[model samples]
Target: MDEQIITNELLKRYLQGKCTVAEQQLIADFLDDPNNLILLHQIMAEQTNSLWDSSADVPQHDRGQITVWQRRLHERMEEEQLIPSDKTKPNLRKRGIIPIRQRIQWYAAAILLFVGLGALLWLWIPQGAKPSEQLVHQKNRITPGSDRAILKLADGSTISLSDAAKGSIADQGGVKVQKTAEGEIVYAAVDKRASTQSYNSINTPNGGQYRVTLPDGSRAWLNAASSLTYPVEFEKKERRVKMTGEVYFEIAKITNENKERVPFFVETDKQVIQVLGTTFNVNAYADEPYDCTTLLEGSVRLVAAHSGKSELLKPGQQALVGNNMLLSEADIQQNLAWINGYFIFRREDLGGILRKIARWYDVTVECPPELSTMKFTGKVSRSQSLSAVTEMIASINKVKLEIKERRIIVKK
Candidate 1:
């Protein structure tokens, strides 16, 4: 088959499953040559470059249809003995193709060729750096975040929790603030002053996470670049806290003097979530399109901060507050993934995933606007180093993740 004869439109149709059986067979045969893979990379790279220049020309292929087509391609290639087996990986490497660390699944392999990778440009080792030196350099540059946060006292004093000893850090009003061995802050009230007007706030930096047990016994798990401000003691009409960014809350059922359960309220810029002994995750990142609250237990009432529109969310529901409020079924595990130290993506876009990578890894991510539509599905450990996480994402999706200093560039 002549390489010049394959048009970008034809390849797009084949990938989109609009090609006839005969045409599909032709593409299959055309892909049989090991060297042809490199040629395809060149064609796709040119197409991608064109897409960048005029994004209006980008194809709108359905992901479900693409998945079906990719699975068929995998099955056909396997039946024809085209996909290299474990023993043939070394041979592929000898032919100037990087050896597959493991057999990549159908969807990943398909996207690697079409949606990502331009001749394995970013994966190749630099000319001067040895493999061992590159490994060492990556380790030193892209390390994981540690226990770190800033605690602001009501008296205008600030404490660096990361540097503070594991003991009583301070006393707010009569509430003794104790930093536990596990890096969690717990509040113990020594005296109950009915009109105590003391408040404290803890803010976590990018690449930082922390937990706090409020004086009312509610626990808040703060994600990277988040902050929580609350009174030192539960007073007044309700237990309220102001929050920014993402946090998971396990509310404690607190009873007032009348033996009635006091409602716990989480106030963000977009909405107010009211609960009584419920577990929920709230993501109100300033950059995200909506303020999302996912209920995992009990119930929650979401009140839009501006319009005051209210919605009641059941245990397995989520409320998204944006220009308009929406309620839908929730994915509890995905909502709480950060609290459990993992990044979970279920058909999430590459841009959103990279935004999270930027936060937790404490790095800036520059993703081409054209790659916004690329989606991924997987779960990665939060404990992994930035290099390991990026490598895993690249391997699973076959995309090139370029890390330079504290900045990451995603290239297709």
Candidate 2:
């Protein structure tokens, strides 16, 4: 392996116990080389110096701990026949080496020592010197989004869900709207006489997300910069809702007085989806070329709003509605990643991926027309800071992403 592959981030991940078994083995192999050991020592010294100035008072115990670990590592190297013993100074060039399996065992022991030292170094560094903090400081920090939205009642009043107290927030035509302790908005019908025509809407701004439980016990999760409008109470015959941007739904089957299942309907600009009881995700952002409806459970029928073209979607199937309706098997996990708190991309174009990042981080992106079509595949936690995410993207694509204030400039 290239010695350059052993980066500070990789070492930090190894020390944090976040590396895969293959990564751990790679690290072990890198450390087994004597020249790489010297390089690692230099890296440690440089990092330590950069983290602590001359006037900084590092604890005496920390200094002693580092010394002890270094001595132990030296002793281990001598025992493994990797270095000449002090008593054999005259025969340094003629030392015998161990067998391959035993050498691997020695490397494993050495890895433990290095891991211990790495842990100590990590703990000794100030908070500002940590990997995440370093990224934040290098580039201005932009925090991840949180659960926040606006609830619009039928009376034209808006309530900020982020600031509302954890209790009843509004009462709309005998329907009680509540803000739960878990940061979700729920609606319950308290009176049978309540008019089903009364409507309510929830709007999530950029860098925000929210979940709402409808009157029929169904749930909807709204992603960043999305909106969902539904009646305060469903009519006896059916439940219907209109939405924009992206939303995930877990529809509940309801039966009327006749004991027949009432169908649920979702209306987007490009398509309308009808389901009996199913889980699905709808991506209807106006900026994208197509509106995608991915079904996870049960069945759904998607009909294009303009052309009247229709298609039935089964579990793990997706219908992409645009100039024409196309149905195919879908990457269910990738489609539902937002609800699961991740940005999972599978050979997705750079423009598509950056659009998601811009929405979640509330930043604008400027990508050249040529680079916009470049494809990348990676998964990153949605909870990470914007710098960490952009850094990962830049590294994966061998490109550069520069952040200026609230905008990102992509360059090759």
Candidate 3:
């Protein structure tokens, strides 16, 4: 394939999952060269088709080999000057194709411009320049929804939602919701729970998340590797739900049988929290070791499941429910930032940040000795480009972090 056919912009967009079908097809065609196609065939031959299709077997078999081949093909295409993709799509009527000579001239001028900039940077800039988003550094700390979750139900049938089909499997009350490809589940609660009907539960793995709604017009947003169990309907004076992971709740008030302040309650692995009317976030990732219940608007009380140790939290206060104790008056915003699509850190140490990153991004963190003590305080939008995050951390002196696709490695 000609390098001219594969534009840098197209490759970047293709990797980012933002390419249109047409643009995607162009990149796929470029990648699926005869040689590359033959390479996959060769890999298949090296292992049985069954093994290739399995998650546990494929990585152990040929994932690294596959990457090596892809890189080889990418390098070959770059060297051959294949297709050139449009970086910007201006109106077709406004911009016309330039002659080959003009393009070559433009490329040469661009090279000189970069060279001049580098010369100035070498003198004025410090010894180590921070990486740019354009560099695609291995040390970016952006997390994505990792496909890892185990669904646990009251009947004891565990369904792993991490890689399940993205569609409606069954009816829950009156809600006809679907599980999206990105793993953000959707449902509209349907009312049909009888008096004796049992409840069901879904658990996300350490690196998983999902969403659900109650039949009483309440919404639940689950965060990584958490589990939630609820009845098909409210069916009582007050509604109640049991959770293990983290969840953001939007409760719809229900009337009491005696009208004596009947309210909805959230019971976690450690605490029984009451919420009548309000929004709140609960984090009970077992792996996190420290469970949190944060109130955004309404008030909630966190009590020990075994000892009955209780603490009432204000709107901005958070309750940290640990295995042995409960502490109130924590930072509510920082604990619940995940629900709002932001990873906000305030002087959090490397180990502490790693726990949060591991849950949201579904990747393991390897922090070397020198960088383990380092702390960071900044706002990294969860929607940030992965490359931009990598560059941002590279801005801090002394510590270094590298992002190798999904896995992140910390360095001195």
Candidate 4:
């Protein structure tokens, strides 16, 4: 097992959303107990006194109020005789003003000051069991997806990018393809003099994701059940990539021999998007009703594949092409939530939400027709187990879920 040492600085970085995913996981692992209140208090002490001044940046309150609660908790710990006796004293380390056990008592007392449940907590604290904590200990829970994908080189050979050892994996047409410790494939073109460019494809299965840096320095993030095919070198007049399913791109700016910016084009089933230097997300799944493109930064032009109709999109705008082409203002964050490790449903139908879950969990869902149209609006962390997420939704919507092997049955 790896040793994890949490520091006040790391906690501060976590509070500021500046920590990496692994760092966030480390902090979460350490914070699973009230005994770890010492670390929590250390974090709080490093911040401003007022709650409003904390990392959340919400409403403000008087600093004296917290001091009053702290004092009240200290007094209650003494009255309840919950503090360990001197003879039975454990080798405890003090982080703040009180011993570790006494600090827990202070926290329980403070809860009483706000929640008015002093007696209930006083009885429960000695047992050291919390309802929320117990619920999390359930043994049956699906694990979230991690680094998993397949890389198809121009030579008709494939490599499992997720399992491949980090370092140079292959060389395609003078371009060095290397897998990094971060589970990303990077292309370093060694010889630009190659007369022809070789194409490579990367595909992600259900419950998988991968990132790639193209030869042009543009970065792409592939979501579950998606594939991207690109050339090993951008020797063409315009850099182009063909993709299926869903992907997010940060296109790089490149200039041609004419001294004009070369346009990057993304071809999907429903439409073609052209941009010079911008960030955007494209959802072109075969199972979905429409192929959608959402622009995040800069601008993009979307041309409908069937009708050849064109629509120019600004940041925070979306273009959807199906039997017809339509444009509307979009929620940029919601579109990019999957890549950022979350599912933000905004009044979406239950069936639509379940489709996303099925893809991520790699399970089949069977729901009654009546429940298909049920609407939901909430954000759930993608890292949560599928059962936990479904249970949460079931509780809120007054529904039940039956699990049979890998299948999920949704019922009223």
**lDDT (C-alpha, whole model) for all candidates:** 0.70, 0.73, 0.56, 0.68
* Cα displacement (Å) at residue 40, model 1: 31
Best by lDDT: 2
TM-score of each: 0.67, 0.69, 0.56, 0.67
CA lDDT, candidate 2, residue 94: 40
lDDT of 2 by residue, 1-412 (tens): 1111113453435545664332233344345566434433333433444334445454554445444555655565656655544464333124332222221222222233455333221111111222332212244679999998999998899999999999999987788999899989988878876787888999999999999999999999999999999999888888999999999999998998889999999999998899998999999999999999999999999989889988889999999999899999999878998887878877678899999999999999999988787666556668777876776555332457888898888876
Question: Which structure among the candidates has the greatest TM-score?
Answer: 2
Superposition error at 175 for model 3 (Å): 7.4
True-vs-predicted CA distance for residue 396, candidate 4, Å: 2.0
lDDT of 4: 0.68
State the lDDT at 120 in candidate 1: 14
Q: lDDT by residue for model 4 over 141-212, one digit each (tens)?
A: 677777789999888999999789999999866789998888789999797654355789999998888899
For model 3 the local lDDT of residue 351 reads 74
- Candidate 2 or 3, higher lDDT? 2
Q: Point out where model 4 deviates above 4 Å.
A: 1-140, 193-197
Q: Candidate 1, which segments miss by more than 4 Å at Cα?
A: 1-139, 193-195, 396-398
